[model samples]
Target: MPENPTTEPTPGLENLLHETRSFPPDPRFAEQANAQAGLYDEAKADRLAFWERQARELVSWRTPFTETLDWSGAPVARWFADGTLNAAYNAVDRHVEAGHGDRVALHFEGEPGDTRTVTYADLQREVSRAANALAALGVTTGDRVVIYLPMLVESVVAMLACARLGAAHSVVFGGFSADALRSRIADAGATLVITADGGYRRGAPSALKPAVDEALEPRNGAEPTTVAHVLVVRRTGQDVAWTEGRDVWWHEALEAADVQHDPVWVEAEHPLFILYTSGTTGKPKGILHTTGGYLTQTAYTHRNVFDLKAETDVYWCTADIGWVTGHSYVVYGPLLNGATQVIYEGTPDSPHQGRWWEIVEKYKVSILYTAPTAIRTFMKWGEEIPDRFDLSSLRVLGSVGESINPEAWMWYRRVIGGGTAPIVDTWWQTETGAIMVSPLPGVTAAKPGSAQVPLPGIAAEVVDDEAHPVPDGGGGYLVLSEPWPSMLRGIWGDLERFKDTYWSRFPGIYFAGDGAKKDEDGDIWLLGRVDDVMNVSGHRLSTTEIESALVSHEYVAEAAVVGAADDTTGQAVVAFVILIGEFADRAADDAGADAVQTALRNHVARQIGAIAKPRKILVVPELPKTRSGKIMRRLLRDVAENRAVGDATTLADSSVMTLIASGLAKPSTSSED
Candidate 1:
């Protein structure tokens, strides 16, 4: 990808570049961050000293660190290497010691309308008990534990317990297929597995333990798993086939265990958790984050980025425990800060479309961090649903997972924020462990679609193919010039892959795999993934740019654009769009669909240029997304290329592909004019 493409602006595209509204930092919240005054300057002066200061200030260390950072090894850097700390103690025991034991730690809302509130003291006791049970099961220091459970409190307890025992936990998303789970477990060589009998989804019980069973079974010439034991949390009490020697119930184990186990402090560089993220090659990379550095950055970023008011704010990060967002925000960050938060155990739309708003109103949630996918879904559902409820409690809104379109960003600010709150569009990944680029609510004047700038103390830039920094307003690959505290230590047991995937791309700089650009004010805008930038003729048009143009139209709620294989143009843009509330009903009629589709094609032509217009427009009810709400664009690429669809195991609803394929059989409302 080249930075600042020299191509002239496509004619008549000016209207699409609407002037974005600027939001200034809130006066009251601006001073709330303890490190706000001299943070960025101090970091710039000495990055090592800044991180060391954050490590010491954020948590109680059992042994003080002598070294701040050791980047002498180049891509494999170490931070606070000599320091000793316990993640569970920081997240739980220390908060209890501060006499904030009675403060609510988790406000668990299950999908079936059940709720449980756990205090810090209660959490500490539970974690201690679970730690003891793990010890009894022979889970020791440096051992890997695979946690495959839902958004239950037990899942949180199990993870903290693993931390308590100095065991690295790898949490596979509950929606992952047995093969996916098996591969992660096999790669990590996990000894113990924690799962639930079943979980609530779409207002009913869904079996999960069966997946674990299948994963453990050696089918299709696969070897038997390394898992020695499976600990089950009786979430829905659904009957599971018993494996006498391998399985034990959570209630049974905890019943026999004492709640007085002490947490052991480990070296700062000791592995905290192994989070497996998918690579382009279809292999799962276990992103490794350590104790002191990962925690320090996670806590620091969460506190300042969200402008968290620990005592006053009711925070909710709508991410599953499987991904990094949940690990950083829902578990470590919020818990370390002793912040009260809502943790839901189900999808946003199970019983009804307004479940999230109901929870927000019910809990008076002040800070809401969610993905753009959910926001767009809400847009599809219409604003009247949220209008029925009071949403004045929300003060800050956030976006994660992917780059939010300007249209979606504005709608999120205006509708969900009640036109008062500021939106923080965060950019980070599983490898980064915490937020890297994002607008600080009370600091920057935000651009709707842009991540704006890297967070203070983080050094990031958009660079051209030769690793040279691109000029302001230029488009290029995004890279981190300096090593940060929260960067992944290695790809578990595959240091070479870690280095090759991230470091090899840009020599010493960390390649983020995304395309980016800076505006006239030097604010950064993320163009989707580098692979997502399609070559149409000799012009490289980003899928994000085309999708943004499609979504800018009032009738389109969400849009996904893929470049299909073409003989003439090399790759032709094929778009899938979801219509807004009444538009769906209207678009269902063939005549209306053709008219609207033609208008949208012209809309994109006018927005960018005829070169960027889609060759076909398919209006569908839903796009195939993962359970984590990420659009599986690879599948869309397969659809566009007319290839046999690859594995649909990761999709939230794999059956949607059938409908889409069937829909594709009909004459498309396409315009090649």
Candidate 2:
């Protein structure tokens, strides 16, 4: 009867794609959009000018960029060809020098009830101390160091210190196994390791130093390990086996170092970090981003995309420092812009599902950016959880990690964002280094399921398998037409692998890995990976579409879909649905759940088509996700095909396998069919 009773759209929202979309046109926002418009124009006309303008946006030296981009060397691409600037200075000193020192840079709340307010000045000192400590460890420009710490101050410190010395840092998620850490360490050939003795996890101390120790076990030769020293912070004072002359305590080492280390100026192309990305190689691919150019784009995007006003805004990107979202948004993006932000070291539902809402209320966070998986988790907990705390200060919300299903997207827009804040459905990857295709808050009209339009300077196109542009409403591969300032340099050790993996996908174009469909208005809707698209009865269907169909079912909590081989059709879609707890408990006995399961199958057929319906629907307890909220569909596919799974090392809970395995090989039937 009532038209769904949805919240009214965000005020002053501009439609970057639809020329006819109306807006109130605020002067300040218009002026900014105008200036940003110039950069986009320059980028399209004279590429060099585009990059030079990007550098000028941030604090820089007397001399400006002499050259913009150089890719004459096949694999290694250089950005801001000949420029000098310091990442630490750009992030810390410049903000402090600009009289924003009193502004809170990091509202860091530890998992163990400890709080630290790090202002710009304080951050400068901490970064300097860390820099001096790192320098004393013989770290210099171009040196690569492995950071294996938990979500504590030292993780941020290690990143800043590496930038200060012009050294590249690789931060492996603390949840990763020693073998995973060891692969990254050896690949980077890092001379130093940074970690904590132990860090708080769900109100308890968990050992991290031991993992680092086991990782370095392979290099126990007389000449000493490639990791010359391990800088361990005493988070829990847990007993750690001392490797005489190799293990250095943080308090003793860094506290003794000078707190006024000068920042080292670096070329625009000087490597800032080597973050690893997952792929078929089994060995992780290092996605390298440079200092000046990377931060230039990062700062610009944070300002315009989030409509951030540093002096007043309390921004919080609830991403662990392990992933690219943290590298761009959590630490570098906010700090570079001199914005007050919150960083917590726990899950959304640690002691209670209300943890995130409490943090937002406690810090009075205005802009909260998080993931779809988390939003869905909050949704599972329901409105009562958010109602427990005052989250009215929140003005902007963000989604990343994976495509947010329309249902979860609508739920997030209403519940977490309080119905008025703009949701920036950001889409990018570790290789991209920054947000590329996204809806700019307050500027772009909101789209529930679509990312809306490419950022002004980003040139994205949906191309068919043959590398030809696809028409409107046609699903195809996503590709970048040009390289931007923050594009990855190359794969760390193997340039050929980098070329083969990303570049070779479609020659001359940068492959985005994800499949996409552009609307008649040229707005992009991200489907999952190219490998994720399923061909059912010769009709192409995205796993995202099928999963979305499954989620639309009332009883389903979350769904993961994969294509499995069948003799009749090319492939059959296999779905795994995690039922809602109430329904799950009710259906604990076999016969009770069968009716709901049948309803789910018919739901998918009605939503898309009969051809898109899955041949099998497995009921699993939970879908595997990284510390960041990305589902490991690769592992799910392994489970679907009755194949032994690959790596479960990064999962937050290894016991989830027991839950998933228990459901496998059980007879399943589609409800409606």
**TM-score for each model:** 0.97, 0.93
User: Which candidate comes out best when scored by TM-score?
Assistant: 1
For model 2 the TM-score comes to 0.93
Cα displacement (angstroms), candidate 2, residue 65, comes to: 1.2
Clashing pairs in 1: 3-475, 4-475
What tens digits encode model 1's per-residue C-alpha lDDT throughout 277-388? 9887858999999998999999999888888889899999999999999999999999998899999988887788899999999999999999999998998888888888
Question: Which is the leading candidate under lDDT?
Answer: 1
lDDT of 2 by residue, 476-571 (tens): 778988778788888887888888888887888898888777766667777788788776656667787787778867788788899887777778
Question: Candidate 2 regions off by >4 Å?
Answer: 1-48, 219-224, 664-667, 670-673
